[model samples]
Target: MDPEVIGAIIGVLATLGGVILAFYLANRLTLNDSMDSKSGWRKELMNIASKDEITLADIYRIRASVRYYPYPYSETNQLSFRWMSSLIINLCDEYFVETYRDKHVASYKCSNSSNFQPNVTISPENDEIVRIICRYLLKYHWEARQKMQIFRRGRDLMNIDDDEPSEDVARIIQLILEQVDKINSSSPQNIFQISAADQLKDILNTAFKKLTITTRRYLSK
Candidate 1:
């Protein structure tokens, strides 16, 4: 081989090696940053769990008329009910996204909403916004059930104890729909005012506990 040709080949190889090294280092740094951001949330969550506290204060409790309130989310629930529901739903949604901080799934979760909006570009596995919402709510239900005999799904009546979150969520959702149909003999009327507005605060408290539990589980993984 000519001396000049050999030198040229060595230069090309050196350049290629540098490019590859640069790429690997950049990717490594990004991954580490992602992990650190995740760890920050997890550590904060652990502290919250250790203290067993929720940051959100109870909703305003003064008795007021809700008879003329605008329709809240296609439902007729009172203003306080909607606000409380949306708050917990949004919190659960946040933790669900946190679960995938290391992956591309983080952007799928949007804050400041009652419902989970599935991202169009996300894959099916990562786009389980609805399932994630239910799982979070179910966790709350399980915790609340310990204190109260209510919130029982039909599965409980059948003595079919199950630990699978997906299956339980599905069955509970189905049963809720079915029960809604059976109980309503006529078209549903708009509830101008919710009598149990005060109880929404209780629900919020239980729901936050579930968020702490589920968030910790995801961080551990």
Candidate 2:
């Protein structure tokens, strides 16, 4: 080959190699960032779960901390909401296991009133938390429905009944559904409005009571 042709070939080969190396590094960095994010989220979840007492307030704080950026609507926010909802549900299960199952509360003395409560006052901030919880539960139920549909389509290959949610989860979901129903029926405009603070307070109060009662009944039996 001519000397100029040879140099041109070398230049093209070097450029291609640099582009490939850049692409590989970019992918590797993205993977690393994703793993780090997941690890941090897991640590935060476990930190709450490891607590001696996980209150409704703790759950609220966790939900608030999980940012749903750009406010109101985004695919990233939706996924974050779903993951946060799952974490909250798992934490509730852990709380039940720690407070009742592990303690053998059927044979131990336990107050039905002392299970879980919102430590915060009935203010707009608290109302926002309740609204978030309501939305999370709604999203969870919707996701569960999607899962059920998928299971139904594959029922011949898998036992769909095996995917049923736990009794505790079912009960809590029922509570959320009932509250959501009331909110839907009575004050549609008051979904998350601070102006509808009283209505939100009532919903939260009822939910808290139901949860406490359910926990009590489960522990009693």
Candidate 3:
């Protein structure tokens, strides 16, 4: 080959190598950033779950803010309210699912639900999730549903067998149903699984009583 041709080939090879190197570095950086972000999220969630007490007000403060963004990134703020709901339940569900998976609760349809049941089985860890669910996810779900355009598929899966939500008991019933709705609605991508029924028999005790009820006849018994 001519000397000029050989020189041109060498130049092309150098440029190609540079491009490949740049591409690899860009992808590696992205993967590292992604892993870091996930790690941060898990740490925050565990912190919340680990707390002895937290209120909706505390959660509002924790919501990723606007004025403070890491180099102008707000993608984390756009996370669906549903995913936030899932995080609490999903994190707690992992340990229990292996040891105490409730077949009926997993399969329970929400449309016909009378009252929402939570497994108050009380794990040494992650038990606070019950309070989080009752306090935030239940109310937030009702509020969030107003945003989406939902096509009516059927009458309803969940129902209250008691008097139509006259006093505050009705509100309690509705909250329970919303939770079951989210749980039953879980899929491979978005998890919201939590046990229901007589498993967590004491669930109606402390955190729940303080959540949304004013006074209720049904809950008294």
lDDT of 2 by residue, 1-221 (tens): 89999999999999999999778656655664586477664455445544544445555455544433322222222223333344344333333233224334443344466563323233233333344454544444335334432224534211123322244444444444455455455533553433333443453343333334544444344
- Name the TM-score of candidate 1: 0.21
- Rank list by lDDT: 2, 3, 1
Alpha-carbon error at 33 in model 3, in Å?
Answer: 3.2
Location of the lowest summed lDDT over 10 successive residues in candidate 1: 57-66
**Candidate 1 C-alpha RMSD relative to the actual structure:** 21.7
Please report how far candidate 1 places residue 182 from its true position, in Å.
25
Backbone clash tally (model 2): 0
lDDT at residue 220 of model 3 (Cα atoms): 43
Give the alpha carbon lDDT tens digit for every residue of 1-221 in model 1. 99999999999999999999778656655664586477553343333333322221100110011112322333412222333344334333343233333333343444456465433232222223233333434454344334333235763321122232233333433443343333333234234112111233344344334343433443234
Q: Candidate 3, residues 55-135: lDDT per residue as tens digits?
A: 333243334311132211122211223223233333233333433444335535433666755332433222343444444
Q: Candidate 1: what lDDT?
A: 0.36
RMSD of each: 21.7, 17.2, 20.9
Against the unseen true structure, what C-alpha lDDT does each candidate score?
A: 0.36, 0.44, 0.40
**Winner of 2 and 3 under lDDT:** 2
The C-alpha local distance difference test score for the whole of candidate 3 amounts to 0.40
